[model samples]
Target chain A: MDHLVILPILLPMFAGALLLLSGRASEGFKRSLCLLATLLQLPLAIALMAQASGGLQVYAAGNWMPPFGIVLVVDHLAALLLLVTAVLAIAAVVYAVRGDDLLGANFHALFQFQLMGINGAFLTGDLFNLFVFFEILLIASYALLLHGTGSARIRSGLHYVLLNLFGSALFLIAIGTLYGVTGTLNLADLSQRVAQLPAPDAPLVGAAAMLLLVVFGLKAAVFPLYFWLPKAYAAATPPVAALFAIMTKVGIYSILRIYTQVFGDTAGPLADLANGWLWPAALLTLVLGTIGALAASTLNGLISYLLVVSVGTLLAGLALDSHDALVGSLYYLIHSTWVCGALFLFAGIISRCRGPRFVGRLVPGPALSRPTLLSGLFFLAAISVIGLPPLSGFVGKLLLLRAAETGVAAGWLYSLLLGSGLVSIIAFSRAGSTLFWRTDPAAAAGGPVDNVRLAAVLALLLCSPLLVVFAGPLLDYLTITVDQLLDPQEYARQVLSMQISTSGGGH
Target chain B: MELLYALTLGVLTMSGVYLLLRARTFPVVVGLTLISYAVNLFLFAMGRLHTGKPAVLGQVAEHADPLPQALVLTAIVIGFAMTAFALVLALRAQGELENDHVDGRGKR
Candidate 1:
C-alpha cells in the first residue's frame, strides 16, 4: 500500500508514453486505452485517500532519506485533490473520446502527461521537484491548449504561451534565490531553517516568497495576472477546458501548501509575510471576476469568467486564514472545480446545439434539441455556481460566512461574498434567458448530440448534488486537513524524523 | 569577475525585456531566449563565483555548491524546449494570420 503512493504519477506517465508510441493504433484502441487508464485512477486515488486519513505518509524516492532525496507526501488534502483529478480526467476523457481526440494526434498522450504532471505536483515534497512538475504540466498544457487549433485558439495560444514563459522565468528565479539562501530545497527542512533564520537572510527570503506568490498567482488566474485565462480556456476544446478547471486550483493548492507548511505562523519575523498582500488581492479578484462574468459576450466567455470568480472566492477563503474558513474554502474548492468543469462541458454542448453560426455566442439562435433536460442541468449548475440553496455552492458559502462571524473583517467578507453571489445570479440568469428563452422557434437545431459526451457532462454536473449529500463527512475531513496544515511544527517533525526502514545492500 | 558577471546578466535581461515588449512574434521569441540565458546565468551564480573548487564534500575544506549547477542545467533544457515550441507556434500563427503581430492584429 505504501509503495502505491507513487502510482498516481507513474501510471499516467506509462499510459501516456504507450499512447504516444502507439501512433498507428486505431481510434477505438486509443480511446479504450485512455479511458481504461483514467478509470483505474479512481480506485487508486480512493485507496490512497483511505491511507492518508491516518496521518502524513511520505514516500522517499530511490530509497533516499528526507531533506536529501525527493519525497512524495500524502496527506488528506493531496489525496483529495488526486481523487478530484481522477474524476475530472475520467469525465474529460469520456467526452474527448467521442470526436475531439481526432482533431489532433497525441491527444490521449498529452492528456495523460498533463495528468502525471498534475499528480506529481500534488504529491511532491521537494521545492525543486515542484518546479519540474510545474514545467511538465505547463508544457503539456501549451500543446493541449492549441489542440484542434483555430484562428481563435492560435491567436490566444500565442499570448498564453508567451505570458506563461515569462511566468516560468520568474518561478526559476524564485526557486534559485530560495535555494541560495536556505541551501536546501526540501519543504520540511526549509520549514525548520526558516523558523531559525538569522536576521540578515530575512529580506532575501521575503523577496523569494513574494516572487513565488506571483508565479502561483499567474497559475491561479488571480486578478491582474488572469488576462490569459478567459481567452485560453474559452478557446480550448471543451474537454481540455474541463480538465483545466483544476489547473488554477493547483496554484491555490501551492499557495495553501507553501504558506501553511513551509512558512506558517511560527517563522519568526516572516510570520505573516504573504497574508497582507493575499487578503486584498483575493477581494479585488472576486470583485473584478464577478464584473467580468456579467460583461461576457458569449456563454463560454461567461463560464470562463465564472471560473475566475471561483478562484477569487477560494482565494478569499484562504486569505481568511482561519481553520473554519480553510475547511469552507477546501469544500468550495472541490465544488467549484467540479461545477466549473461541468459548465465548460455544457458550454461545448450549448454551442454545438446552436450550430457553428452561434458557437457559444450568448445571443439566441435556435431552440436546443433537448431543451428540457439541457435547461434543467444548466439551471442546476447555474444555481450551484451562484450559491443558491439545496446545492453545494450555498453550503460552501454558508460555511465561509459562518466562519467570518461579526467584525469589520466579517462585514467586508460578507458583503463581498454575498455581493459576488448576487452578481453571479444576474450573470447566469442573463445568459440563461439569452441562450434558452430568446431562442428562435422556427430555426433548425444542430445535429443530434453525442450521448457519451452528454453523459460525461451529466456525471460532472451531478457532483453538485453529490457534494451536498456528503458535505458533513467531507467537512470533518477538511477540518482535520486544516488542522494538519496549520501545524507546521508537526509536519516538519514528522517528515524530517522519517528514517529509511528498508535498508538497501550497502556498506 | 563578479561585477562583470552581474553586468552581463543585467544587460541580457534588459534587452530581453525590451524585445519582449515589442508587438512582433520573432522579437518576442528572441526576448524569451535572451531572458532564459540570463536566468540560467543568474541561477548558476547563486552557487557563487568559485574557481577550481571541488563540489563534492569531505575532500577539500572549501567546496563549491553543486545543486545550483544542476538546477541551471534543468532550466536550460526546459528553456530549450520552450523556445523550440514557441518558434513553431509563432510560425504557425504567422502563416495562419499572415502577420507576425503577437495578437494577430495589423502590423504595428
Candidate 2:
C-alpha cells in the first residue's frame, strides 16, 4: 500500500532523470521508456484507487511523524484524479511518439517530469509540498510549451508563463498568510487548527482564502483571469496542447481540496461579510467563458473556449455545492478531460490534412472517397462535449442539473447552467460544421489524411461512447468518493493519531 | 522591520502590476521578476521575524519555522527557472517575429 502511494510519483521522476542523463539517446529508446513509464502508472493508479476506497492511506517519509515531517496522503478524490491524469498522459504520450517529427528524446524527459509534478500535487498532504509539485509541473510545462519555438508559440508561451507566475506569487502569499496565522504548513494539521481560530482572526482567513481563490482561478482560467488561455493553448502543438487540457483542472482540484478540507463550514467573520459575493463572480465566469467559446473562429480556438466552458461548469458546481452537484462536477471533469483531449487530437489531424490556411475558412475539402473514420470520431467527440444523450458527457450534465435544481440557489443557477449548456452546444456545432462539413478547394486538391495521425484520432474517438456506457458505475464510485471528501474526519484522525503513535513509540 | 518588509511588498506589487500592464515584452519580464522577489520575501516573512533563530536544529533557543523557508527556497529556484525560460522565449519571439509585443497579435 505504501509502495502504491509512492510509485506514481517515483516512476515518472526516475524515468525523467534517466532520460535526461542519457543525453542524446536515440528517439526510439526514449519513446519506449516514456510509454513504459506511463503504462506502468495505469495499473499502479488503479491499485491506489482501490486502497483509497477502503480508507485514506498516509505515508510519512523517513519514518518521521506528521506536523514535523512531510507526508503523502491518498484519499478517494485524489486517486480518481490520479487515474484520469494517467489516462490522459498515456494518450498524449502515444500520440506524440507516433506522429510528431519534432518530439525528441528531451521532450519525453520533460513530459515525465511534468507527470511527476502533477501526481505529487494531487498526492501530497503538505501545503508546501503541493507548491513544490506545482512549480515542478509549471516549469516543465513552460519548456514544453515553447519546445518548437515558433513566433506564435513563443509569444503566447511568454504570456502563459507570466500569468502563471502571477498566480504562483499569489499562492506564495496565501501560504505565508496561512503559516503566519496557524504556525503550521501540514494540511491535515492545519485543517484541525484552522477550525480552532477565534472570530477576530476571520479577516486573515478570508484574505487568505480569496488570495488562494484568485491564484487557482487564474490557473483554472475563470473569468477576468482567463484571457491568456486561448492564445496559449492554440499556439502549442497538438500533442502538447492535448496534455495541457488537464492542466487547468489541476487548479480546480486544488480549490476543491482546500475548500472541502481546510476551510469546511466555518464562515468566520469575513465570510459572513462577503456573503455570497463570490457566487456572482463565478456566474460571470460561466457567462464570459461560454461567450468566448461562442465567438471563437478557429478549430483550436473553439476547443480552447470549450475548455473555458468546462471551467465555468466546475465553478457553477462549486457555487451550488450539493452532493449531486459535486458528483456532477467530478463527472463533468472526467468527461471534459477526455472529450477535450480527443477533440484537440482530431483538430490536429484536420489541420494537418487541410493545412493551416484551410481552417475556419468554411472551404470544402475533397469529399471522403473512402470510409472517413476520423470524421466519425470527431463527430462523436463533439457530440459528447455538447452533452448530447447516450454519451458520457450527457450523464454528467443531467446529474449536475438534477443536483442544481434541489438547491435554494436553484432559481438563478439553474437558468445559468441551462443557458451555458445551450451556448456550448451551439458553439461546438459551429466548430463541427466548419471542420467536417466545410471544404476548401486547395484542401480538396491535397490528397489523403496521414495514416498515423488519423489512427490516433480514431483511438480517442472510440473512447467517448465507452465512457458513456460506463458512466453509471463510474458516477457511483465518484459519488462515494465525494461523500468521503465531504466528511474527512476519518482522514484527519488517521493522520493525527499516526503522528501520536509514532512519537509514543520513539519516546 | 515588519513595516519595512510590508512597504517593500507594496512597492513591488505596484511596480509589477504597472509593468505587467505595459505593451512590451521586456518590461513584463522585468515586472514578473520583481513580483517573484516580493513573493519570496512575503513567504519568508510568514515565519515571523526572529533574527537569532536559524532554520536548523541548535543547542540554544527557538528555531524559525523551517517549513516556510524550505517552501520559499523551492519557490525561488522554480521562479528562476521560469524567468529564464520566459527570457529565452522573449528572445526567440524577437528573433523570429521582429517585434516584442507580449501578445502575439500586436498592440491591442
lDDT of 2 at A250: 91
Interface RMSD of each: 0.6, 1.4
Worst 10 residues of 2 chain A by lDDT: A266-275
Residues A8-60, model 1: lDDT tens digits: 99999999999989989998998999999999999999999999988888998
How does the DockQ of candidate 1 come out?
0.88
Off by over 4 Å in 2: A101-105, A266-278, A359-371, A406-408, A442-444, A450-452, A499-507, B104-108
In angstroms, give how far residue A442 of model 2 lies from its true place: 4.8
Tens-digit per-residue lDDT, A404-476, candidate 2: 7754577667788678879888887776666566655444443357666666666665667777788778888
Question: For candidate 2, what's the TM-score of chain A, rounded to 2 decimals?
Answer: 0.93
Off by over 4 Å in 1: A505-507, B57-61
Candidate 1 share of real interface contacts: 0.86
At residue A199, what lDDT does model 2 achieve? 71
